[model samples]
Target: MKFATTLSLLLLLSSILVCTMSTPLSRRHSLSVIRKLNREGPFVGLITVYAPEENAFLASNAFKPDPRHPFVDLSGRRFRIGKVRGKGVVYVRCGVGLRNAVAATQQMLDLFNVSGVIHFGIAGSLENSLRTGYVSIPKQFAQTGLWEWLKANGTVGPEYFAHLDIGSYNVPEGEGINQLGHIGYSAEEFYSESGVPNVPRRVVWANVSQNWYNIATKLEGMELERCLNSTVCLPQVPKVVIGQRGSTANIFVDNSAYRDFLSKTLGVSLAEMESASVIMTSVANGFPVIVIRGLSDAAGGQDGPNSARALGPLAALNTAKVVIRFIELLPSHKKYQDLK
Candidate 1:
């Protein structure tokens, strides 16, 4: 849900709270970057996680640049200020991992008069049916990295993923699953920021904007890339499946057992490292956002070697295709016009 302006202001008071100190680092950073750039727009933020993904987006024919100043620099980062499908867009590579994603996205929003955000990149498929090269525009994203290390005297959470939900993920914590030594995955808690005063909020899923989801849904059944090259092809044709819940974690998932745990517990179709942060930040600021992920591997369950080694570039290219199409279709939408 988008945070209300009144509630957003109230959150500043948290700096004086006893549970924590100071405002969220993103808020402070936002003020500084906005003051510095001081730009205007209804510009949509296009963010990607690393070079391969960014490069693919750049190569798209849809990335039409503003001839006068197609590129700009901010604090050593290069951002492409352009148009996608005739909609104003500012694209940047938000390096890998959760923290990097949060920082880079916040900077982009701060530097431009951004109306919304679109983040896309490669992912490891958590669902076996979602083969390598398939693109997933998940309706919701969850940060799976947040957890509580339950020890021998453990109790089920009011704070974390339930004991029943995370039981399979528990390692041999010096004893059996009944003991507190296991790790319990948890929902990330948002205090005061949830917009209701004095309430510490927790969520099982963070959502993307429905309007964006409506636009993205049109891409379903659109053709996807199925081959890395003539000979190196995926088992079958790639597809764009929308609305499945996806997940993210700072850790790269390469083990099948861990992947199964996430899929069963979270109903995740795809898993990656950065999009959850982007969605959370955008939601906090009341901007529409969406994440598109292409499966590069099967989260360690692929028949052969992890497909990402040879499949990353190909998967990224497919996501770029979907994103570009989405942007092209975005122009003149009732929702975006409201932003202007």
Candidate 2:
């Protein structure tokens, strides 16, 4: 009787172990099934917004959340997978700044097979030519935090810089400071070292996809809001303009002198916190990306403090309208049939 009881206990323990191992397998299978379902329908386009104000505009005016499709990623990032004018889209409000933009973009690419990405939001005008509520599409996007080391002195520059490696596609070597070199001075030997810093740094420029650029040109005459409200209004009617360079950095620029410098040095029409990172990530991943920005504030000078508050809503609305039109212009799902 004692031997029989011991054998029964051993059998029960073996059954428990098997069940434990199978539990994880079952969970994995369930996750796989969920991901498969998400990808089964059609190629989805991604639209990202960095702020709640912009998100509010998008939710109300542009894309509608599909009750049938709600998704939250492993990182707890919630997404509204839905349709805009019958096109599949995923809308994510990635919080402000470069890190948030990059992380959210990477997560989306990992989770979904997105056909393209479009980022639209408010930006400060770097050039006087642009004013609040004017929508501008970037011909090229660049990051602007790099500094050049002054070889004459050990000090790093006031010289802003950015670099792109050779052989990258769709990257234009823009006019200012475009050269190939190492990060810091490197010499074959101590004797070969130039007394000055020989460190190679190229000004990096990431261009919008040519196909998207062509599409933007077609939107040239679209009307934009010039008024803050019926009571307060812009001096002139605003219009959508295409093909200007834009720069991005974490810094909220409020100085007039620095704004002028950026305009001249980078040929930048608008400055913002997130677009360059989004463009860079999309380019590296071989995904097409476009950025449409509405000028909310003139970077410093007279129109600085109240510009974003006064013009932000109008700017966001203008950008959303353009994004909607762009979505409409996208070719049928048949073009993306093979993507599935």
For each candidate, the alpha-carbon lDDT, in order, equals 0.79, 0.69
Tens digit per residue, CA lDDT, model 2, 78-187: 66677788887876777788888888877777666577788878889988888767899888867765433333223323333532222222146333442342232111
- Tell me the deviation in Å of residue 44 in model 1: 1.3
The worst-scoring run of ten residues by lDDT in candidate 1 lies at 173-182
lDDT of 2: 0.69
Clash number by candidate, in order: 7, 2
Residue lDDT tens for model 1, 1-340: 3568767767866644743436556555644544443354667889998888887888877888878667776655777877887778888887889998888888877567777899999999998888889899999988888876766556666566644434444566323555435577788765423487667578768888888888889898998878767877877999999888887888888888878877886788888899889988887767789899989999877666887868899999999999888887776533674542
Residue pairs with backbone overlap in model 1: 150-180, 151-180, 151-181, 152-180, 160-186, 161-185, 161-186
Candidates in order, TM-scores: namely 0.81, 0.73
